[model samples]
Target chain A: MGQRPGDLSAPARLAGPDEGIGADELALATRNHGLPLEALRHDVTPPGLHYVLTHYDIPYVPDAGAWRLTVDGHVRTPLDLSLADLLSFPQVTTRVTLECAGNGRALLTPRPVSQPWLVEAVGTADWTGVPLRRLLAEAGADPAAVDVVFTGADHGVERGVEQDYQRALPLSVATGDDPQVLVATAMNGAPLPPQHGRPLRLIVPGWYGMAQVKWLRSVTVGDVPFTGFQQSVAYRIRRTPDEEGEPVTRIAPRALLVPPGFPDFMSRTRVVRPGPVRLSGRAWSGQAPVSSVEVSTDGGAHWEPAVLDPVVDGHRWAWRAWHHTWTATPGEHAVGTRASDADGHVQPLDQHWNRGGLANNAVCFVRVVCVADACWP
Target chain B: MGQRPGDLSAPARLAGPDEGIGADELALATRNHGLPLEALRHDVTPPGLHYVLTHYDIPYVPDAGAWRLTVDGHVRTPLDLSLADLLSFPQVTTRVTLECAGNGRALLTPRPVSQPWLVEAVGTADWTGVPLRRLLAEAGADPAAVDVVFTGADHGVERGVEQDYQRALPLSVATGDDPQVLVATAMNGAPLPPQHGRPLRLIVPGWYGMAQVKWLRSVTVGDVPFTGFQQSVAYRIRRTPDEEGEPVTRIAPRALLVPPGFPDFMSRTRVVRPGPVRLSGRAWSGQAPVSSVEVSTDGGAHWEPAVLDPVVDGHRWAWRAWHHTWTATPGEHAVGTRASDADGHVQPLDQHWNRGGLANNAVCFVRVVCVADACWP
Candidate 1:
């Protein structure tokens, strides 16, 4: 097989800011203050290290003492709900992974003209909030409403357009029976941080981060598809200005290798004896449960099925851990991992080229060296 | 000196796009429709090979027969001038090099989110047009005007902001005595191509390409600086979301090596005998003329002065050629080059990190192998 665009023979490093994820309580990744890949090693990412991708620089922190979320526009009964009112409704909690649409964008060829993300821009979090369907029902959303637009308080001019960060979902998805679609107020059993979303946020499970409007202020029911900047222009894949490609939506099937974090050069510290070396990582998909994961130790020439952890109910968006034990040799080697979902949506060896570089889920690899005389850890 | 972020020991190639510069009559460079670094080999770059960068996918092609440039807002005489009217006015021509602010961005560490550009996103061309100062003068621009906002016909939404491709210049720079600041209608003695701004374009000498509003439709004089999305937010370099860094404007001092383009593996077609090899390239700066250029054949450890070419009058933005001769060694070696401008602005061995990855002018190097028995070219 031909080498992928970003699969360099030597380890590749990006230039500019340092993106080291230190042992700090709150480790901040480099671009847009995102989470580091280290955070994904945990079955449930720590709240502090959960990737936070905000559109605006200053995330809006509503004064809980006076903040209100107004539900109107194409509603039979307009409603204004405060924090207390939102909390009064029955709450739903779910563990879901939110990946940036631009994840792995840096790996794209010809390169898109936006955030150049590697594969680290994703995190899974346990969110507690009221089901969005309940709020829409309480507000008596009009049957004719075709879409529900979620508007955030974060407003800024991007390109040349002045806009409040907004995105719309088809009414079917907005008012679906899926209890995972939430108007979230708390995360990891704590109130949302100002950087995440203070008073309220929209968490659309299985969708990319853009669909989960942070710092959410209002939910409006509209009779037509929202033609907001974020919906119609910014997020859609376009080969040219005139050609409108599909709008980015769900997360693609992906598997991430977590062991052997250090490269081969750091063999003095990371190398193991010529014995069995255990490898583990996580696999996920938006369309279905992770059905299987495969590991390759000879640069993908041979593959072996990995043992997957049992799936838990009610966490459809949660990733599944997979493990493999490899008998090591006393030399350098490349290891790779790939996953397939229950729907048979398998991770591609390489990502399909897109103008916006969205939805990249190419297989990931790590290089490791084994020391002949070293003892097992 | 330590290796810079992108100065890999081996010659590195950009991922995704095939940025090949064909050897046709025009020799158009691939990837963003830009000019290849090889085009800079000639003191006066061939018109056909000149680079073109367009924001929108479809370049706006105005009907020359009906196109009108409107000059209004804070102007004493609001005028709608046709192509003929623009042609009737006295014209000015100047050779200027235009570079994208994101040039060399791919080389930045941590990688800023935007076009992952290498160093090739720049070009020089002789532009013919009416001096913008003259046009503003004819319109009787108000003396109190603080900025001149140039608006292009191209419109699109970027990052959720809907904007006509627009940029603003401080009044002084917009109406300066510099004849290079033009309302360009022709490039390299030919009518501008649609992709190069067919009807009219603003040519702000020394500024990055963003300041050159292409497909010009209207010029608005304003009492306050234009706080357009591209100006106040998107282009600024920020360390954090809240701390606004300075807006990027002028091009930084930079020098690029031209010859020895292919790396060692391709030496069969490009290698020369183990003797003195002549090397040449171009240098330019927004603040001042390039004062000196240094070349290093053994990584960046040793450096020697290169012969600087004489500067031509009126082509202030044009890069000057620098030449060096290196005795060949029959082995692989890394060659590097850097430049210093007259204003004491020296090219840094490494780039200062910026969030937008703007204005990267780090020292660049190329890897080549000398053939032992080949005769000198």
Candidate 2:
């Protein structure tokens, strides 16, 4: 996880059985607005269990004490600053979702051939960091430095390819003040856990987890593009059928892109343990925020609007949890849900096929299993 | 790893050394070429320390249990054969390189963000698999089936949007008897490495790694484009800068776009041990076989044809190993190398920048380090 600055592993864990106390690990604590993993029942993904994507293995990075962000690639005034130097500037926090580009690649058309991933491929957290613009101004970055190179403490060789843990972003995005963009050192209001990037990380709200690099390191202002494999190669989208089969290079605006609704825990089988079963799940968009999440008790005929939480940070990629309630039932029935963003985007009727399994925002039908008695397999 | 068959978290290991010392591994050994390393090396990459990218974690997957090659989807007679079923048919071999679509992305312009890989991504290897033609004929694939979807054994989630681990080649490529399209179970004549995908992988020479789906599960026949995430969203090439200030989308044929020549040991500092230092490395083409190789000691000013071994396959992505003998030097000098294919295709000065870093076959360079009898630090 020492590859990028804000890599995603898990953040919290119980120190003693008493740690991670009630509500402390709750999703609301972060305002990510997602459903509880009622199946797992416990709040918050424990550190070890949190999803992780580390470009390089654990890197022994320069201490925050000596850490400096250098801006000189194609910049006017080359600037270098220590952690304290970085912190000397203003700071802000934003709640956002960091999902790996490869998170759902397994379901791709050619089955994106990369690392395997599981359900625990994403998480949300509050990030605090200096605005990239602030650093750019200080460095007097040249517009010619169209790209910014980000280096890390991890290094390795892959496929006869000598690689340094690094990647580059367009100066446009790097210079913007996305509240979701953070030079974060904490998670859930605590210093980052080792697995979650102990010292610092770059929390890129809507982009895939790969962009939100883990481990605090150096940021270089460059003229040409940074040629890190992660930047130039992996985590891209291939839209056409051609000889070289070029890739979708830049990050697409974040959008849920599918099944236009928050998931609902309809018709609970928790007959005895429940007064009235409450249904809940998270809905979000990368391209646009949610317009209104719709739920259907009978497949696609009848529809109802689920309660919406206040959207914050203008983060479209961060999902909002929507909840519904249903009385206990005696048998199996079909229940489906869909979500749409502010742009009137609706979930698809079926799957759209592509090479890699990316942008899979599709309508999901969660079959409700209610019983006269609590009987779950 | 199980959820995504090709994920890195699998338990696939190098089976007790010789567990993989079969025909495929033997092929590599017989040539006395290449150094296989378990991990990366520092500075000058030891032949043994080069990285290897495999489709599957386990190697040498036979059709023994459930390794069935299916041509379902929209085909006439969906072919579902076992490993042996595939091998029994006339087998063929090709010398080609399997490169990640993200290979030369590091050289892109906008500097789309992702992995931090230095050069050394592309590698060539010998591969033997079933001709897609043979299986297509046997499956009685309908002429109407415009595209053939190649699937893998890995389990994955599917968005109603798209949930398929498959790639589709026009019926022409899929049905071509060209020996290059293979259901390869071995690499370099040995059981394929797990990471490289064992139990039979697809070797579609002349394209990026995306075309070669490792741990092949099933091959389906479809009349439509495979709309999986990998196909649609991943691997897309961003053309020129757009009005949206984002990368555009398109696809090109994928290949190991490398500059001409075998690797020239960039030894800036000479080795004290004057023993013959063998110059060796692998080479392959995305669309064709490498016809010849050359090396330069004085920066491409003078050139000499280097020794190239007999490559294994034709018009395949499987790569070949080339080596040469060089005398030790104790002075500072520059070295460069280049390679060309049968079709006269040579490496480019640089790849055209697209949003996604996909196929980039630029020539490779090594700055030899030869000191006055100084030990490599």
Comparing only chain B with the true structure, the TM-scores of all models are: 0.87, 0.65
Please tell me which predicted candidate would have the highest lDDT against the true structure: 1
| Model 2: per-residue Cα lDDT over A184-204, one tens digit each | 766766666544555667766
In candidate 1 chain B, where is summed lDDT lowest over 10 consecutive residues? B21-30
Q: Candidate 2, DockQ to 2 decimals?
A: 0.01
What lDDT tens digits, residue by residue, belong to model 1 across residues A88-190? 9999888888888878765566555344455767778888999998999998999888999999977543443446889999989998865358999988787
Model 2 chain B lowest lDDT segment of ten? B30-39
Kindly report the docking quality category of candidate 2.
incorrect
Q: Which residue runs does candidate 2 get wrong by more than 4 Å?
A: A1-36, A39-50, A60-66, A108-110, A158-160, A178-180, A239-276, A296-303, A312-317, A333-336, A365-368, A374-377, B1-377
> Please, what is the whole-model Cα lDDT of each candidate in the order they appear?
0.69, 0.48
Q: TM-score for every candidate vs. truth?
A: 0.48, 0.42
Candidate 2, residues B250-361, lDDT tens digits: the string is 1122222122111211111112224355565555555556777776655567767778767443334444556666664644334555677767777565556555555555
True contacts kept of each: 0.00, 0.00
Q: How accurate locally is residue A203 in candidate 1, as Cα lDDT from 0 to 100? A: 89
Candidate 1, residue A27: lDDT: 10
Q: Which numbered prediction scores highest in TM-score against the true structure? A: 1
